[model samples]
Target: MMKEIEFTLNGTRTRTETQPGERLLDLLRERLGLTGTKEGCGIGSCGACTVILDGKAVNACLVPAQAVDGRELVTIEGIMQNESLHPIQDALIRHHAIQCGFCTPGLVMSAKALLDENPDPSRGEIQRAIAGNLCRCTGYEQVIEAIQDAAKGGKTQC
Candidate 1:
């Protein structure tokens, strides 16, 4: 049976019908056409599918589509405004944190969630926030630097 679910996606109200046991990852990628959220590990061990759900970062693959009803979700695609990249994204690019670009979205979202809650987080705190996210390519040095730069108000000027 398909059930209707209403929620806020990327700051916009959205409604969709989800099949039983459908995951939010599939809903976002397949149904809603939001492919920025990637699925690396279907079991949630890898944070490639991370997204901000109601102000907290979560693995979209582990969340039931129906569970998101009346909630707010922010994917990497929604973090930008006016065709400009978010500060985290800018910092990541400036710091050369992206490699292969497969895990960038999840890292960005995790960093954003941390920054949203704590504007100025310590290096250790930033590390903790993104510990769940595994980036095999970058090794997290530049990624951590990018988050730090973003915390220091480093925004890329286009």
Candidate 2:
């Protein structure tokens, strides 16, 4: 059965009719047309479907659409403000953190979630924050460096 769900998506309040068993990833991409959130392993092992849900990073593919009825979600599309990229995005560009760009969105969301809660996280903490995410290209060094640079105001690390 399809039910109406209301939630904050990408900083905007949205309402959509979703089936009972539909994954949040489907809802975000198919229903809302937010393709920035990718689906790699669909079973939640690959963090390609990561998103920030109410201040926590979670695998969108693992969450039921019904579960997001009243929560706040931040996707890659929502990371920009006033036509400007988020600090995380800027850092990624500055440090060449992206190679294939398939996992960039998820990685960025996860890093943003981490920095949102703890602006000055240690290298270990940053790694832990993005442990769930899988990056086929860039080998994670650049991603880690980009995130660290963002947290330290572009100085490369804290």
Candidate 3:
């Protein structure tokens, strides 16, 4: 049976109908029309379906839509404010951390989760935070540098 779930998404109240076993990723991308969260490896290895759930970074593909009921969920599209870019997005640009950009949204969301909790995270902490995200381009050095630079108040990298 389909169930109706309500939650806060990108700072807005939203409700959707989901099957008993529908993943959050499917609801976000297919039903809710939030395509920024991509599905790279549906098994949750690639971190492409990463999203912030109750202030924690989680793999959307692994979370059932019903699990998010009454919770605060943040996606890549929700990170922006008043047309201004989120710090992580700015940092990625300033650092040139993106190449093909397929993993950009997930990477940015992961960084956001880290920065939101600890604005000035250590390098090791930052590394641990994003360890799940896999970037096929830019070698991750630039991505790490970008995140670090952001912690140090540097401007956008790309």
Candidate 4:
């Protein structure tokens, strides 16, 4: 059976019908057409399906679609504003932090969540924030640098 779900998606109010056990990643990619959230590990060990759920970074693959009802969700597709990329995204590109791009979205979301809570996070904090996200390429040095650069601005609205 499909149940009605209402939530805020990408800053807009949204309503949809989803099966009780449907994963949030499936709902975003299949139903809503937000494909930036990837599915590297169905078991949630990989952070490719990360998204901001109620201001925290979470693996969408591990979250039930119905569980997001009445909550605020932000995906990689929603991080930009008025044709401009988020600072974290721009920093990633400038720092060459994205390699192959498979894990960029999740890493970006994780960094965004950290910056949102603590604009000035230490290197260790940044590492811990994205520990769940595994990236075979880039080795995380560039990713960590980008997050640090984004923090210098002290803005994490996106």
Candidate 5:
């Protein structure tokens, strides 16, 4: 059965039909052509498919397409505006946290979710927020630093 779902996607209202049990990942990548949400693991173990759902980071692969109806969803493609990168994205690049870029989107979404909820999160909090996201490169030190920089607007943190 095909069900119609309407939700806010990347700040735009989107209406589309979704098959029952269809993964949100497929809907974004295949149906909507939003490929920033990667699918590293089909299951929820990997956060490569992370997206901000109603201001919280969630695994798109684990979320049902119909479940997003009437909800707000933000993918990597949605975060930027006027062809400029979001602060988090810019920070990641400046910190050299993005190497292969496969996991960058997920990490960015996770960090955005955390910062949205708590603008001044501690270093440990940043770690916990991105714990689900696994990056084979960068060893997380730079990623953490990047998130911290974005959180503090590049100010010196005590």
Candidate 6:
């Protein structure tokens, strides 16, 4: 059976129909047409489906579609403002942290979640925050550096 769910998606109130067993990844990418949230492993290990849920980064693949019925979700598509990229996205580009582009969205969301809670996280903290996200391209030094750079001025309404 399809059930109606209401939630705040990228600061907008939205209502949609979803089956109980549908994954949040499908709901975002297929149902809602938000494809930025990629599905790498589809088993919650790759962290490719990461999204900010209620102010924390979570694996959308593991979360039920209905789990966000009353929650706030922030996907990669939601981070931009007025045609400008979010600080995390900008930093990733400037720091050359993105390669292959498969995992960039999850990395951005993860870094955003960390910076949201701790605007000035230590290198170790940054490492821990992105530990779940696997990036074979940049060796994570650039990613960590990008997150650090974003921390300098990344704390905003994003």
Determine which window of 10 residues in candidate 3 has minimal summed lDDT: 149-158
**Following a full C-alpha superposition, what root-mean-square deviation does model 2 have from the true structure?**
1.8
Candidate 5 pairs with clashing backbones: none
For residues 1-158, what per-residue lDDT tens digits would candidate 2 score against the true structure?
98999999988899999998899999989998999999999988879989989989999999999999999988888989689999999999988889899988899999999999999999999999999989887888988889999998775632
lDDT of 4 at 46: 85
Q: Cα miss at 156, model 2 (Å)?
A: 5.4
Instruction: For residues 55-127, write the lDDT of model 6, one tens digit per residue.
Output: 9999999999998999999999999979899988988888888779999999999999999999999999999
Q: What stretches of model 2 exceed 4 Å from their correct place?
A: 155-158
- Whole-model Cα lDDT of every candidate shown, in order: 0.93, 0.91, 0.90, 0.93, 0.92, 0.92
lDDT of 3 at 138: 79
| lDDT per residue as tens, model 5, 1-158 | 99999999989999999998789999999999989899998898879999999888999999999999999999999888688989888888888888899999999999999999999999999999999999997779999999999998855332
Residue 138 C-alpha lDDT in model 1: 83
Which candidate's TM-score is highest? Answer: 1
- Expressed as tens digits, the lDDT of each residue in 43-125 for candidate 1 is 98889999999999999999999999999999998989689999889999999999899999999999999999999999999
Model 4: per-residue Cα lDDT over 55-99, one tens digit each: 999999999999999999999999997999999998888888887
Predicted structure 4, TM vs. truth: 0.95
Q: Global CA lDDT of candidate 2, please?
A: 0.91
Kindly provide the TM-score of model 5 when superposed on the true structure, using C-alpha atoms. Answer: 0.95
Candidate 5: minimum summed lDDT over ten consecutive residues — where? 149-158
Q: Model 5 residue 82 lDDT?
A: 83
